[model samples]
Target: MGILSINMDDPMDVDALDAFLKIAEYRSLSAVAKLYGVPKSTLSLRLKQLEGELNTSLFLREGRSLVLTEAGQTLRTHAADILGRCEAARMAVAETLDDASGMLRIGATGEFGTAFYSQMLFAFRRRYPKVQLDLSFFSPHTLYLPERQEMMDAIISWDDGNAGQGGAEQLWTDRFCLYASRDYLARMGTPATPAELEEHQAVMFRQPAGPQLWLLQRDAETLSILPRSDLFANEYWTVKYFAVASEGIAYLPSFFTQIECERGDLVRVLPGWESAQQRVTLRVMRPSALSRRMGAFIDFCRDYFSPGYVFNGPRYYVETIFNPTNTTQTGEQR
Candidate 1:
């Protein structure tokens, strides 16, 4: 028989549980101590206290590796679960604070995330000093889970392609322009119209043939301008580079090449030819409504990337007053 029976009514030693869980995740005492900014001796003392309470040899040494014993592994799983619950509770408490302070996990496409509103990244850090914003970038062409429930609090993608999803805000829209380096244009004659794209060395964004297909439209006319390129890249930025290095003609966002086009680093072909529309939309993944922190973020975008800036579509004229009328006819409205 055991020396003593376990008491069912005793409270859990949360501090010890936290330390143990950290040790398990990292698999090294020194690592955990370094992470927690504490001495190894202190961590060892706490681990011993936990083992004594549980009455188990929680770990076994194998060369330089620390392996969890059978008993240790069992306890570790439960310990992690308990620690997770505690963290959730802590998060709930922190969320209730007046200021929006906590982690905001965000996911977005590569080029769009950096290019469209790079300023917002800095602004968010400055404004919400307490909020830890983590942005995970993915390729725009890749299919990702976008219902707003998994792996992200918010997302940025092409609006036209991803309509009727959850809470969405139109960040900006820019017409695609044909870009080729000066050398490439000199080698291959500059295309004068959409029809001529078929005759050129084109690098195309391959779309799967389905109902949810991308249409290359110009001036409200959907042209059968199915241009092809031997060299293909999923990232929009990569396409720009290919064009600059004389790989092929790439249809890319106007604003992305604004500086390049102005400086003549890459020449814009077919100025009169309207390129396809690309919409940069910000999406939130919440069940019913948004939190205070989430709402604040949306407002921040509205103020920061305002009209006449990134959000201003092709139809927007400098002199005319800006309004988000659903009637605005451009490649992408939002």
Candidate 2:
């Protein structure tokens, strides 16, 4: 193949360039002409003008079939790129004239999305009534699965290690904490130290792959908890329920246990301990260029989850859990 130079004295026509690219794509001038609502003769004439400007034979005809020459193939590459930029600019301008309207699909674990993020979703919809919001809550382990990954426009969940390979941005940081209902604590006699956790019956969250290990730290000190237990559940709410039923000690996200803790329904096992902080990031693995609606949604999420965003849950207190008078004198489990 030989290099062909365009004459700077004469620039190519944008419409002609678009037609040339379309002809290259369809491989038939008549087909492209009909698609564009133009005559076949006009398509050929424009392409000839483009070829004339470049001073090369654009195509060779064999009977009714047209084949592109080496130079024509080169021009086709440049023409497609030039045409794409024009289309993109047109779309960008058109967005400013119209409201952002489209469907946005987000993915996250049922535990986090339903408990915390649902509020954010409702707020987002209030701002963009024209844009439909679809929040899909899936199992935690399935987040990185190829099919599920393809469905989310944006995802809000714990930083999945695999997601870093794609477009993952850390939105917030949170830590898990050991929590057990007052009833359970009363029955187990409260594990004052991390070492005492070994003797206490523990309720644990089992992921799809296996049980998650419990690691806690405080400054230079650290502890690895291997609690003895029989109770297990996948859902965080279920784990909380089991703990409330005096089943065992459960470790849950701090945000989820905040209400329970404040009301004294659940007590922190080790006040000195802090679980390793897990980062939560907004991940976008689906489309290459986000639509206007999706971009607006992402921006809304960043601010909504910001630390400065004031949020407080309604104060709730249970008489049986918080007041000794409401319970039996023994305060002992059945």
Candidate 3:
């Protein structure tokens, strides 16, 4: 007895193996045809061709049902492995091609999507013109849910130090600090300490459950304050602009206010204190077997937010932004 052989060069024979697997799994030729939208005759013909090539009776029909013969059971095991390896080889070739082409689905929070990842993704599209991006924004709470995570190839989200067992790659840590317009500071008087924040009005970030306490830290001391606020907004940019218009002091992330601080549109209020810190992370579903497009995107983002990158560091009002002699053209300290 010799080993069985099927002509892999014949496309129909290859497809026949696939049809055989489907039929074996479903145990119904008509059912597989209906599910795959292929004609029953086409599947039957392919199955017969596959059986002929191997000189084996793959299936035995008993009334309305088809049961796998001993040969079919044996072929089933090898067919899946053969088809799987073929797919792997095809993907390996595709990954090596210079141009990566595919639809890459990504998820991020609305704030981060608008303020950060959107710009990064725009640049990615420019670099890989063939890759189509489908970016969707979700709330931080629901962004990483298993059902939601399944829909995206990758997700950029805040790592609240609770992403247990979930593969999350830390991109960068963003710090939030108090900010106010020069005019607001002049009119309301700049706060010298967290104690003075009680006297100043605040542009609060409205949460679903109403305003939350602003947690500020300096050295070993930590203080939580609910600043006096008549103004409230859910969006970061809106809060920044509201503060810019001399409405009130705003607690904002350093990354989002870099440009405004550089232009003297917004001033960091307490250089010694930081309100909050959030670790940004990239969660790729399958890191080991990433597509070329996704791999390029992950690399680009890692480099974009890497240490010593111009836009990756903290921007201070008194030191980096206001000090004309110390700041560079990229809005970072020299």
Candidate 4:
């Protein structure tokens, strides 16, 4: 018996192969069509042509769904490798032209996306104007889901030391600490100890797994307190806003509060004690043969989060604080 080979010379063979791969991935012709903005009939015809060329039935219709046959499973194994190699070759050729232009899809938690990543992305755009940025915000719980992950090239998330399997590069560790507006402390009277937290109202970060106990640590001692929360928000930005409004004391990440703290809009309630420490990480979903745009963005982010790199964004107070030479000299100094 002779082995049948697909003719690569025909352009239709390539389109059929691409269609077959997408259909196999989504398990539906309509899904593949809708995703790629192609007509369902076109995908069906391509899939049929592919199956005919291979001389095998690829899919079996199971009620409302389509399941891959044994032959389809075998083809899928090689199809992904074939497409990946083709893409690698394409990216390599594109790099030779020395152009950093492409769509970079990124995913992050809503809070982090709004509070920090959005600003960083804006800064990135100023440098690479040709690269289009698509930032999608997902819930903390659903951010790591495989289906959601497939939609993004890179994902920025908090690594609590339990992200198993995938290679996630640690960017920085953001420490959560107690904070409140100075006006709130003046009105409520600042707590001298951890136990005194019960007397003050809290503006808390609402967790999907229900209420969380605040675990405060100082040196060798650890204490847990369930403060009465009047304001609860899923977004850290909202919690910080309420805290700045003097609604209650907030336990927020230091990264989100840096500008506020520097501006004296919000003051650390208990400077000596710290709460949770979340390690921020950037996970590149597609790690092989990264495009020039993707490589440039990753490198920019690494330097942005580096130690003592004060953000020189619109409200540039941190730059003045970090780089005193940038500050205007007063008459007293002159």
Clashes of 4: 0
lDDT of 4 by residue, 281-320 (tens): 8888888857898899889889888886666665321111
TM-score of model 4 vs. true structure? 0.67
- Per-model CA lDDT versus the true structure: 0.64, 0.73, 0.76, 0.75
Candidate 3: which stretches are off by over 4 Å?
A: 1-93, 160-165, 308-334
In TM-score terms, which candidate is top? Answer: 4
lDDT of 3 by residue, 1-334 (tens): 3235555665435688889988886789888887778999999999888877877788888888888888788888788777767756765777878888667888887875556877777667766888888787778777778756655788887654444346788888888888997767888898998888989999999876788568889888998889999998888767776776678998888888887788787888889999666788888877778888888888888877877655433332322223333222222221
Higher-ranked by TM-score: 1 or 2:
2
Candidate 2 TM-score, C-alpha based: 0.63
lDDT by residue for model 2 over 1-334, one digit each (tens)? 4457799979899988878766765679988877667999999899888888888877777777677889988887777668667656754664675676756778886766556777677777777888877677776577768756654677777756654667688777888888887766776688888888888998888777766678899999887766787887777767777766567888887887776677666788787787887877788754478678777877877887887886443332222333343353333221
Instruction: Give the Cα-based TM-score of candidate 3 against the true structure.
Output: 0.64
Clashes of 1: 2
lDDT, candidate 1, residue 193? 65
Global CA lDDT of candidate 2, please?
0.73
Greater-lDDT candidate between 1 and 3: 3
Please give each candidate's TM-score: 0.61, 0.63, 0.64, 0.67
**Comparing 3 and 4 on TM-score, the stronger one:** 4
- How displaced is residue 13 in candidate 1, in Å? 10
Error of 2 at 283 (Å): 1.4
> Can you write out model 1's per-residue Cα lDDT over 1-334, one digit (the tens) per residue?
1232233566558888777766775689988887667788988888887777767777777776577787777877787678657756756787688987766767676655556545566676677777777676655444255322354667766654663466577876677766776667776787776677777887665433421222355565775455665776655666666665566877777777776666565777776554565677788876354655666777776676677534322321111123233133122111
